[model samples]
Target: MIPVELWPIASSLKGELLQMQRPQERFAFIIDCFKTYLSWE
Candidate 1:
């Protein structure tokens, strides 16, 4: 589960993902977001 502090970020990411028109684009975006989050840690 995501921490409370990160809920806002998670929510915004979810909103963006839902707005994406293609699965490929969503998949790529998710990967990029994951990479960025990993780098932050």
Candidate 2:
């Protein structure tokens, strides 16, 4: 289960992914976002 604090970030990522046209770009974005988020914690 996702922690409550992460809900905003997850929602924003979903929004960005929906706006993206290419599958590769979406995949890369997810990877990059997770990397950044993990680094913060």
- Per-residue alpha-carbon lDDT of model 1 for 1-41, expressed as tens digits? 89999999999999999999999999999999999989999
lDDT of each: 0.96, 0.91
Candidate 1 Cα lDDT to native: 0.96
Candidate 1 positional error at 4, Å: 0.4
User: Candidate 2, overall lDDT?
Assistant: 0.91
TM-score of each: 0.88, 0.75
Candidate that scores best on TM-score: 1
Q: Which candidate is the best by lDDT?
A: 1
Candidate 2 segments exceeding 4 Å error: none
